[model samples]
Target: MTPMIPMIPTSTTIPLLDAMLADPARAQAPLGDGPARARTGVAVASFIDGLRCFDAGPTAMIARVEALAPEAQLFAWEGVGLAAEARGQIDVALAAAPTFAPLLLVGAGWADALRGRKIGAPRCAHVDRWSVLDGQGFCLGLLDRRAALLEFAPEPTVALAIDQGIGRSLYFVHGGTASAIERAIMDVPASRRGALWSGVGLASVITNGLNDTARADLRERGGADLQLGEHLAALLLARISTPPHEPPTGWAATVLDGSEPPIAVLRRGLDRG
Candidate 1:
């Protein structure tokens, strides 16, 4: 069994992050664009590292992300927002990025518990409902931030629990190999597949706009690739008969660990789950 890892406090992280980013060599080091599966991990870690000591509180987190390069900024913002939301600071999360508002509005049944009231989950058509690049066709030659986001968005999976693990895992699959991924997922025991897919979908939204190669690929493949990706994502979501309700497992609560650092919690969740 995977031992439960406690969340690391930011008080412990902020100083370490400060030291790393302050180093001229380390700060200037190239940030490589890794594979889709590892993309979220890289972005979440980078967000935590990029944050400075002076940038305290949730609002500062958002501001810090804004200073990063466009690709990094989008992923960092999503990471900050989702992590903050898990910690019960919905207001802070939304302020981090207005686009994040939809994440909370989605079938987040857990929100009621956080808000201390029973609120109905809104009908969310696409997990990326709040993405700024929706409905826009991304041409291969014109792969910008918007194109990258659309290109790299993960295909939806079933929800075994209401958390980010499944979503994070989905990021591992290259967009072109989505059909093979679906087949492999179907091979998992029927009982566990929902949780697996749900985690992937959750991570998809958080790390939506982080890929650089996907952008280059779009520039190379042209609009057909973009449309194909959207179609595949839709098809995958359709396979998930489960409604977008929060998973009964206490995944989000663990994710929403208010007292601990979101990066540490997510890293452990990805590794152990």
Candidate 2:
């Protein structure tokens, strides 16, 4: 049996994704198809908010902590925002601190632009996820399923545990100091990235909240040109009624056990502060 993995402390950043999804009012707001659209919006909003918080806090911390711990595992992604903000954060972080090394997991398309760019390129792994066009006139990978956490400096040391799961994905850069990470975050385009990020999360919620017919109709109507938000909302409603089949894997078994109330109960008790 696989040993139980501890849940990392959540980062204390914005709860954009959670807020949007949790609110039925927002979920029920009319975006296009009236009530249905509103409901979809709510879910999308929650997802986006969650993504933002993850990126700014948990995602960033995972890298730093993994560098120090070397046994930690991270599962996360970027659901919204422009490629520029994502890349900019990494670049600034690397530039501000030379002592720390940063490792990045990028999509196959972004390998070229992010390779050997000086900012934070300790190591770059490719994962199949999503991509975006940056303001710099470059296509950047937005999500990945695999990554490495490495240290900065001449020798470029890897300082963390690297693991991957079939459906579970990991993202972010590691092996960098906290200060460098902070500087890099500062460089992210706040307004534009924030909006885009929120939109993406909202889209996810919407997708997960749709009914079968609505989802099918939306898909048939839009195809690739479909509005992300609308498409997601319908899809979500459909999925809620009928969840997708889970792939059989050891990791899936582990996650199921880890999510049991017994473990969650113990965790809550420990957090009674």
Candidate 3:
């Protein structure tokens, strides 16, 4: 069984939010087209407001901490309110404090937020793109800074300081126990330390899939261990091939089934090394 990790009290939420909003560079990292990006920002802002209203105790703590940071901008996306309009459009909520960068994204509805857009999982795909772009992403800094990601899907929630000058990303997967997600985030890999940010993103996607039982059977049968490197490799492999509708029987099956050839190749390389 995976070991338990400490839970981040809701109190830290607001301060983290403030940090993300403070940095325009991080906040405006071109996600998609101009209108789409605007909408994304709104969705994030709205989520933050919702969090404040929904959980007062944590919001108070976050507010107090945020008072110490630099100023930031907050926005929210309410969406079109049509059932059919909800599919791929993301609903984002945001908040900003005076200490760190502005908190760009508080809550995200992956399905409704980016309606009809196949963005995959933002955290996972974002990290992969970063890796492909520069052979690294800001994940290493996030790990060093002790940041994490939190999700509560059907609506995925991410809490972290993006523009505090300390680059880090944190995320939680849908249906996962908060404690487990925290533990996984803190257990960043040692070898590919530079890829910590991307790893967190990848981990979220895998865990999200697993939580939904979409990939549970495969994980169990594949004999797959939830190590960061292995998970990243597996996700890359799955993305390139026909990801199993559900988890495969075992690691061998997952790798051999052509669902994850990249993982298979990585395993071979590791064996040789």
Candidate 4:
């Protein structure tokens, strides 16, 4: 059995996020962010608010994300937003999607396969041009060496197609309408949502809410990656569901809550059944 990994201290990750939020250069960034960029920005900000550290609200954080959109890759922005916001939206998106869209989180090895033409380039290219929440064809983009690919279609067919693929992947069969996916993401719980945003693999660390054991387990099952950190700065400022200015205590408070790092207390409070 694998020995459980200790939880990463907030101290190790908080400063990195703090610096991203404070950089003055992000102030005058995105000149004319389109819908995809705007939605991606909102998703990014929602995760930041879930962190409970920086006080920037959706309005301000969205503006900031828009400014930075031009300087950064769109997937770099979307990946972060999805990492933090997927948790809130996943259940609902799955429920609301008209067809199941398989969202694939690929590893560096798989990305290389695509670039080298080892595996055929996605049949549907530049899927990112369509919203993961609304598009019909797959949205393909890089998260570092990894690639996040999505195709809205029947789950059984998509799953079978992927199962026969040349590389490894972790995926979700999301169902629901495009608008539903968007709305559900907006409804994600503010505090613990940080924890839920923890994606399936190495990228899980980007949120700093899940312990190593959980992340590792996810990796073993082919569910995570390393690209989650791309939006750490924006996620820190995403909106919170808790009442304004009232810091949550107990497990209600996540490590992202810099004002009150309550995971320890919350963990201690849970009955060790």
Off by over 4 Å in 3: 1-50, 54-190, 194-273
Better of 1 and 3 by lDDT: 1
lDDT of 1: 0.35
The segments of candidate 4 whose C-alpha lies over 4 angstroms from its true place after superposition are: 1-63, 66-76, 79-199, 202-208, 221-273
TM values, all candidates: 0.36, 0.25, 0.21, 0.20
Worst 10 residues of 3 by lDDT: 76-85
Candidates by TM-score, descending order:
1, 2, 3, 4
Candidate 2: segments with Cα more than 4 A from true spot: 1-30, 51-56, 59-87, 90-130, 133-206, 219-273
Candidate No. with top lDDT: 1
Residue 22 lDDT in candidate 2: 47
Once all C-alphas are superposed, what RMSD does model 1 give against the true structure? Answer: 16.2
Residue-by-residue lDDT tens digits, candidate 2, 1-273: 322222222421224223333453542232334214434344334323323332334335334333431111111112222111233343332232212211122221133333323322322221211211111111121222112112221111211101111001101121112222223323433322222222232232323434566445534432332233333223323322223444334422222121321112222333452
What does candidate 4's lDDT look like per residue over 1-273, in tens digits?
A: 322222221321334334334552331132113213333344344433322211133333234444553323222333333322222222232222212112212211122222332233232232321122111111221111123332212233232222212111111111111232223223433321222222211122222333455434443433211122212222322322112345545544442432221222233444331
Candidate 1, residues 82-144, lDDT tens digits: the string is 334334444544544444343222312222222322111212223342221111111110112
lDDT of 3 by residue, 44-75 (tens): 34334433332222234245324421211122
How accurate locally is residue 56 in candidate 4, as Cα lDDT from 0 to 100?
Answer: 32
